[model samples]
Target: MLRPVVVGLDGSRESLTAADWAAREALRRGLPLRLVHAADAPAAGGSDLPELSAPRHWARRILRDAMDQINERYPRLYLSAEQIARPAAEALVSAGGAGELLVLGSRAFSGFGGFLAGSVALQTVTRVERPVVLVRADQTVEDEHTPDPEGRPSADTPYRAVVVGVDAVRPAEQVLAFAFESAALRSTPLRAVYAWRLPMVRAVAEAGAHQTEEAAARRALTAALAPWREKFPTVEVVEQAEEGHPAQRLLSAAQDAGLLAVGRPIRPARLGAHTGPVAHAVMHHVRCPVAIVPHE
Candidate 1:
């Protein structure tokens, strides 16, 4: 059976937005869409107030409403909804097992304030092996598309490039593959960004060595992407080497990108879900959708 694209729904605007994004992605991949809700069970020894059951009812209602919207939007798309009695993170991770991709929503802060990804999103992204994408509540389809040359809004505009962070010395194949595939799917260019700065202690020793360092970084990125280029011959690949923080570079590159792809090394369950600094930074700051891919 084909794996479906799963999305976690909590009735929040963020979640609804993610569901819509997932629906469009499902259509693009020709996969089914599954909406999941994790309703926290009532606490034990709690008073049997008549309103106690309202939580369960609300959860079901959320699922129903989301299903209706998605069904109406993608009438031909196969969709299903389920409400599980468990922690949100646990429910999402379990559902992710059978999913081709798992999507969750995030709420962006106002002004220059940073957004919060919530613990559920953090936990799910770290634990799930499948690629998990986080979409901000205010994101629109047009946000993923490029603006007209004259800076006017137009639906006919093509999508912006797909940006992927690369660790030249230790590039992750899973991350590279996903980035290339996304660019190919959208018929957009792929910008592979590698960020590096000489260690403080080596700064003096490496003085006037910026050119050599940049050359090496570029070569590393090119070599790492060689196989993928062959696999995706049509994708226009751009290699960018920047001397700065990886997270900052990626965030800047993603300003106009349709999607930003990053990798999180999978650790044993006992180690817990560590998102690492770079992935953690972008998940909260990037304007575009962020795909957290787990690699061995």
Candidate 2:
């Protein structure tokens, strides 16, 4: 059976927006959509207290409302909902393990143009083995497509390109596969960005070495992407090899992109799970949805 696309929801607009994005992605992947609410367990002796029961009641309401909204928007979609009595972070990580993808919503900064990942979302993203996608509250279906000739948002227009941050020296197969498949599904181009920096000694001493380093970087990027290009012949590939921070280069390339994908190397729990700096930066600043694929 095909695993469903799971979305973690709270009684917030951001979570609802994430549910909506998950619904569309589920449709695109021909998978089911599962809405989950992680409610706190009632106090042992305080179960009879109205305050304790009120939160659980509200949790059910959140799930119900999300179901109704998604159903109205996608009548033909197969959907399911569940309310888990556990801590938010724990529940999200466990629920995501059973699904193909786990999507969480982020709150956009009030005055800034970036999104903020809350403690719960951050914990889940760092720990979950399954791919986690972070969607901003302001993201809409129209934002995933190119504007019309008159420069108006329109879903009828073609989807924008999908961008992926590639590590030329150690490109993760899972990351490339996911990126190529996403672009293939949307019939959009795939922009592969590889960023590197020269050693300080080389930078200061060998001023003419930049051309050589850049050429090598481009070659490495092409080699890393050659097999993916063959695997997805129809996915137009745009390779960008630049000397800079990976996150900065990816952010600039993804300015008009539909989706941005990056890889997170899995580390032992004993060593604490981290999304890494590149994934962290892109998830916060990119307007497009960001997918963090966990790889070994």
Candidate 3:
């Protein structure tokens, strides 16, 4: 059986927006949609306490409201709702592990020029083994497609490309696979990007040396993509080998992209959880949905 597309809700507008995005994706994948809400369990022997009643009611309301909105939007989708009596991060981690992927909402910082990824969402994303997609509240279906000839947002236009960052020296198969599959599903192009910085040596900064390094990077990128290109012959692949920071180049390439996917190495528990600098920067600033895929 195919795993369901799960979304975490918290009665916030952002979470509701995420549910809408997840429903659309679930429909595309021909999978079920699961709506989940996490709340702290009531105090010991205080299940019926007057103070605890409101929160319990609120949790149920959150789930019901989200269900109603999604059902109205996608009448034919297979959907389910669950309210977990646990902390937000723990509940999301467990629930996401049981699904194909997890969708969560991230609030954009108003004047602060970045995403307001909360603690619970960040924690779950960094710890979960499955892919986690973070959607902003302002996202809409039209944003996934190219603008109409009139320069107006329209969903009927072709989908924008899906962008993925690749490291020529240490490429992860999981990240490449996810990116290619996403482009195939959307019937859009897949852009493979690799960026690097010149060594501190002055000799390497010469025009001749720069050309040599760029040639090497491009050759490695082509070599790394050979197998996948063969496997996904229909996907139009565009390779960009640039000299710069990975995050900045990715952001520029993804300006008009439908989705941006990046990988995170699964670290041992003793090492603690954290998003790498590349993932961190994109998550905060990218306009499109960011898919964080965990790989070994």
Q: What is the C-alpha RMSD of each candidate to the true structure, in Å?
A: 2.2, 1.4, 1.4
TM-score of each: 0.93, 0.97, 0.96
- Which 10-residue span in candidate 1 carries the lowest summed lDDT? 107-116
Clashing pairs in 1: none
Measure candidate 2: CA RMSD. Answer: 1.4
lDDT tens digits by residue: candidate 3, 18-134 = 999999989988999999999988777776668769888999999999999999999999999999999999999999999999999999988743578999989998999999999
lDDT score, candidate 3, position 166? 95
After superposition, candidate 1 runs with Cα above 4 Å error? 41-50, 200-203
lDDT of 1 at 254: 88
Candidate 2 lDDT, tens digit per residue, 1-296? 99999999997888999999999999999999999999877667665777767888888899999999999999989999999989999999999999999999998877765679999999999998899999999999999999999999999999999999999999999999999999999999999999999888897899788888999999999999999999999999999999999999998999999999999999987999999999989878888899999998
Candidate 1 residue 141 Cα shift, in angstroms, is 1.0
What would you estimate as the lDDT of candidate 3? 0.91
Clashing pairs in 3: none
Q: How accurate locally is residue 149 in candidate 3, as Cα lDDT from 0 to 100?
A: 100
TM-score of 1: 0.93
lDDT of each: 0.89, 0.93, 0.91
Q: Could you tell which candidate, 1 or 2, scores higher by TM-score?
A: 2
